[model samples]
Structure formats: structure tokens, C-alpha cells
Target: MATRLNPYISFAGTARQAMEFYKDVFGGTLNMSTFGDMGAPVDADGIMHAMLETDSGYTIMGADTPPGMEHRAGTDMAVSLSGDDAVQLREYWDKLSASGSVQVPLEQQMWGDTFGSCTDRFGVTWMVNITG
Candidate 1:
């Protein structure tokens, strides 16, 4: 397979819930592995890795922050979804901004597109852009 760039999020003991939320939002097949599955001494139920491959061809991976690592949210990056599929993109923006804080409402932008940004309930930042 060719090298691909995918967003991988790190959660603090909430990886399962966060990943499941993404599955609901993006309509995808989610595969997960736990610490126990990898014979780790940490919380057995903690997510070691989780991958969601959406029908829209989006791939998101996430995991519980390991014992020695820090799980920082919304400090450095944002996940962006952009395309000409207005209907589909609007649907995503609705679901994502429903329970979270909307940094920017989804509306027509000066760039000639509908754009918005929000922080999902899981504290992940998402930016959606729908081209005209």
C-alpha cells in the first residue's frame, strides 16, 4: 500500500468513547485493540489502538495515552474535512457541533465556501469546508 497521512488522536482513558463517537459521526467500520490484547500491564480495557475507515474514504486512528505519555487535547492540530459534497459535509458539521462548542458557525465564507470549526465533545477540533 502507498504511504498515507491519517489523523491519529490520543485520548485520556476515553479513547473507546471518542472513537465510537467518530464512528457514529462518520459512518465507518471501527476496529479496536486493547491493552490486554497486546499484553500490556496497563488498564486492560484501555484502547491500545483504534481505527475508523469511513465510507467517505476518511481514515482516523486513535488510542488511549499510554502510562508514560501526556494526553493533550486541542493544543496543536485540527482535523479538516473539505470537499464539494455540501449535503454530506453539512451533515457532519451538524453532528459534530451539536454537543460541542462551535468556534465558528457553518456559514458562507469570504473564501466562497461554507466553513466552520468546532471542538467535539471529545475535545478534538474539527474544521469543515463545503465548496460551492
Candidate 2:
């Protein structure tokens, strides 16, 4: 499969509604997954994990609060950048993380790719994925 980049958002408990609203606005197909089915505890079943892929090639991912976790609302969004162009992505990651806090240092991950998370200088959280 080809690689892609998408936005992954976090919600308190309205992920389903939010994703649905996005579907209506963007005109896309919504695929949802409940936490419980994906190895989450029973309490997380109510939270929604969804993805919307529009016909125009837009893709968005999102998930609601996890079990035993408190939702910090406004600080819950993430910009997910992913693709097979490892060199360019790594360069971007290095530049972005140079002056910011590296929450997850860029390194070869178990999934056979380079992945990392960081909070940029502007306070926006970002995740970079470079496929191996």
C-alpha cells in the first residue's frame, strides 16, 4: 500500500459525533473502531476511534478518551505526517524537533520505520512517520 499523511485528533468523548460532522462537511467515508475491540479496557468502549477518507484524497484520524485517562481537551490534537520518503521526512523531523521538545525521539521503531512525536515551538503536537 502507498504511504500517506493524515491528521489524528483526540476528543474527550465526542469523537464519534465530531467524525460524523466531519464526514458531513468533507463528504467522505467514515470508518470507526471502538476501543474495546482494539485491546482497550471495557470502559474505553464508549470512546470512538474513527477515520474519514474523502474522495478528494483527504484522510483524518481521531479517537476519544481512553480508559483511565483524563481528556485535556484543547491540548489533544496531533498533526500526523507519514510517507515513504524517509529522507525528506527525517529532515523535516530533525528541523521541527531541533528547537522543540522531543516527546518521542525519532528513531527506528519496532514497526520497521522511523517515528517520533514532538511539541513544536508553537505548542502544536506533531508525529512524523517515515516508512522503512
Candidate 3:
């Protein structure tokens, strides 16, 4: 097995929903474990960890903030999706931007590629770039 690095997002209490939304957009298998499942003292239903592995070789992991942990917004981080497949990337952009706020509409950028950004309903930021 090779070492890999992937994004791990933190949510106040919406880890489950955010991970589910990512699965819908990316078409992947989602595995989630909650605090209760692990017999943790935190909210039983709150997600301890959720991982989405996509067919596109994208792995996204996330978790809900445990009880008593502070969740700060605008964390200066964004989950970025970049590839040469315009069609697939656009599909993801559409679904992800549907109910979220678009920071940049998907369009040709000055750098000569299709690029866009948005902050999801869960307050997680995402950037999608499709190479030309």
C-alpha cells in the first residue's frame, strides 16, 4: 500500500449530511461511525468519523466536533477537485452548488481552464477545476 493524503473536514454537527452530499456528488461508497457506535460519551448520533471513497480515486474524510469542542468557521481550507474530465467535474459542480452559495460560477478562468468555488450548505468550502 502507498501513502496517501486526503482532506479531512470538521463540522459542528453536520458531518453525516455533508459526507452524504459528497457521496451524491461524487458517486462513492460511504462508511460512517458515530460516537455512540464507539461507546463514546459524546452525542451518540454525532459522527465520529465518516469517509467517502469515490470511483474517481477521491477520498474524503470528515467528523463532527465532539461535545465541548469549538467549531470555527472560515477555516482557510477548501476541498479541491481538479481533473481533466470536464463532464464529470461539471456534474459535481452542479450538485454541490445547487443549494450552496457559489463563490465563483463555473466558467473559463483567465488561466484557461474551467474553475469555480462554493461554500456548501454545511459551511465547507470547495473548489473545482477542470483542465482544458
By TM-score, who's the top model here?
1
Clash statistics: count for each candidate: 0, 0, 0
Query: What's the TM for model 1?
Result: 0.96
Tell me the lDDT of model 1 at 15: 96
Candidate 3 TM-score, C-alpha based:
0.94
lDDT of 2: 0.75
Q: Comparing candidate 2 with candidate 3, which one achieves the higher lDDT? A: 3
What is candidate 3's lDDT per residue for 75-99, written digit by digit as tens? 6579888999988888888888888
Which 10-residue span in candidate 2 carries the lowest summed lDDT? 40-49
**Order by lDDT, highest first:** 1, 3, 2
Model 2 regions lying over 4 Å from their true place? 76-132
Alpha-carbon error at 2 in model 2, in Å?
A: 2.5
Instruction: State residue 14's C-alpha deviation in candidate 2, in Å.
Output: 0.6
Which residue pairs overlap in candidate 2's backbone?
Answer: none
- lDDT of candidate 3? 0.89
RMSD of each: 0.9, 9.9, 1.1
Best prediction by lDDT? 1
Error of 1 at 71 (Å): 1.5
